[model samples]
Target: MPSDVRALLARHLPGREARSLVPVGQGLDNVAYEIDGELIVRCAREPDPEATRAEVAVLAAVAPISPLPVPEVVFSDPSAGVIAYRRLPGRPLHRHPVADPRRLAEPLGAFLGALHAVPPASLGELVPLDRYPLADLREEAAQEYEAVAAHVPPEHRRLVEDFLAADPPADPLAESPEEAAAGTAGARLCHNDLGAEHLLADPGTGTLTGVIDWTDAALTDPARDFARLYRDLGPEVYELTLAHYDGRLDDAATGRVRFLARCALVEDLAHGLGPGPRHYADAALAHLVRTFTG
Candidate 1:
């Protein structure tokens, strides 16, 4: 299969001799292979027109404006569900935390600051958020809550359930219940799935090399970008990251971020319960404890 994939991708990489096609990545939505040492070929695991379109479009638009390097789409054939991009340098951040989490926080924050600042009009079409008239989002979050509730420890169950409710108190952020219910403060382009796995950095220097995987890129509440910051790093790093942002997220904007944080737990818990290596549910429950109690 790898050889067949290599043959298929040969026409795309015209000059460089294709040396090896190594299976490198398997994310929820995509399966990726490293062709030679320089490029990546990815195919969707499921039919997602929006994700495919985003990959083809968002990368080109954000490349010049983003503070960090993003993948350069060398070739794409979405219809065939295959696209190859020049693999960016460095390893996933989780494999190697930035040497200086403090300094790294600023640029990361600044990068997102710059990222959100790019004119939305220029980004072409991206997946829009599941916003307003909360019927759908509420239902989805409830489903996630149902899946995770039993796994949550007793002490944290109430808090997680509260957040899972169709309407819950701010718990931490958001201006009002009404605003929280609506799920929109200000909408902008978002990586949608910003996590350590998608962030690449130099193992030696911790210098961030790139922000990859824009398949879920969308025009949504900016907080979606920051949801993982505090959970993955720490408050200090989270604050520093936010401090460097050029754009301002007001009470409303930030409120949505917090709201999304709660909303996102479903996926987090699911990943933990699913085939992942780690028991994310434990961490997920711990996060909930901090959210309400801390």
Candidate 2:
């Protein structure tokens, strides 16, 4: 642990003695630490204080409503840029790879379904649609593509650029009227980043125990949750997840899913350009090409 982090924890945790602190893996923006034996602390690297506060607020709102286990926020001090939660047992789903994809698909689908059931109206004053609009996502992707064009193979670059150029279908998903009805029908709070790494599954039974990381939780198109299923698990698991969701996927929802999947691909390319860029970029371009051309 950095000396500064120790000082920060000491300041926030008060009398609790942190016998040992070790660096734990974190997502793009936050750093994670396992402190002592009972607590997990997350420190935000981003300057925005609202980000940490928003996560704590969202967790508090959704804890009772969500069926799956979500971390309980023990302490949140935005001034310090730290949030702590009681650590839960279980490993990320990606850690214990299931030879049978179906096993993973079933639990993942059910967990997502349960998460999506939380009414949007229930989450008071959390991040709104403007923070993660489709238009914004598109613009971000365009910028990222430009930055990494030189790094990408010319063939792949052409495919990605062309797909972006094609104006996303106006009525590609559902008919306008149907979409309007769905919107008015009421939206649900969704875990926008429901990837394998964020999910914890039991090593023995392969049951999902907990869903961690609420940094990207948002009240937006519910279809966004399915994007991870398609991107990570492919069509079979994607279908299973949709089926388990127990909701009808109209043309609009299907269209939104496709659009979001494409957006995630671009977002990954733009933001995750490193040693792993080649793999992620290739997958994104491939999915975009296959979906658009097919």
- In candidate 2, residue 33 scores what lDDT? 90
Whole-model alpha-carbon lDDT for candidate 2: 0.68
Top candidate when judged by TM-score against the true structure: 1
C-alpha lDDT of all candidate models, in order? 0.69, 0.68
Candidate 1: residue pairs that collide: none
Candidate 2's C-alpha runs over 4 A off are 93-97, 131-136, 153-159, 171-186, 203-205, 274-294
Query: In model 2, how large is the Cα lDDT of residue 162?
Result: 78
Q: In candidate 2, what are the lDDT values of residues 1-294, reduced to their tens digit?
A: 467667876777777778888776565677789887677788777646788889888888778756578899888778767788998777775456455666766666666667676655566578554235556667777887778778666666676777677665342232356445545333457787876667777777766677888888886666777876666556567777777675434557766676667667767666657534254555555555554333
For candidate 1, write residues 1-294 as lDDT tens digits: 576466667666656567777888776667889977888888876756556766777788888888899988888866656778888899986556776777678679878988888665555445555334334555677887787677777876777666655473232234456546755345577887887778888878878889988877776667768876665554567678888887857665454455556666566777778755354555566566554332
What TM-score does candidate 1 reach?
Answer: 0.81
Q: What's the CA error at residue 148 for candidate 2, in Å?
A: 2.1
Clashes of 2: 4
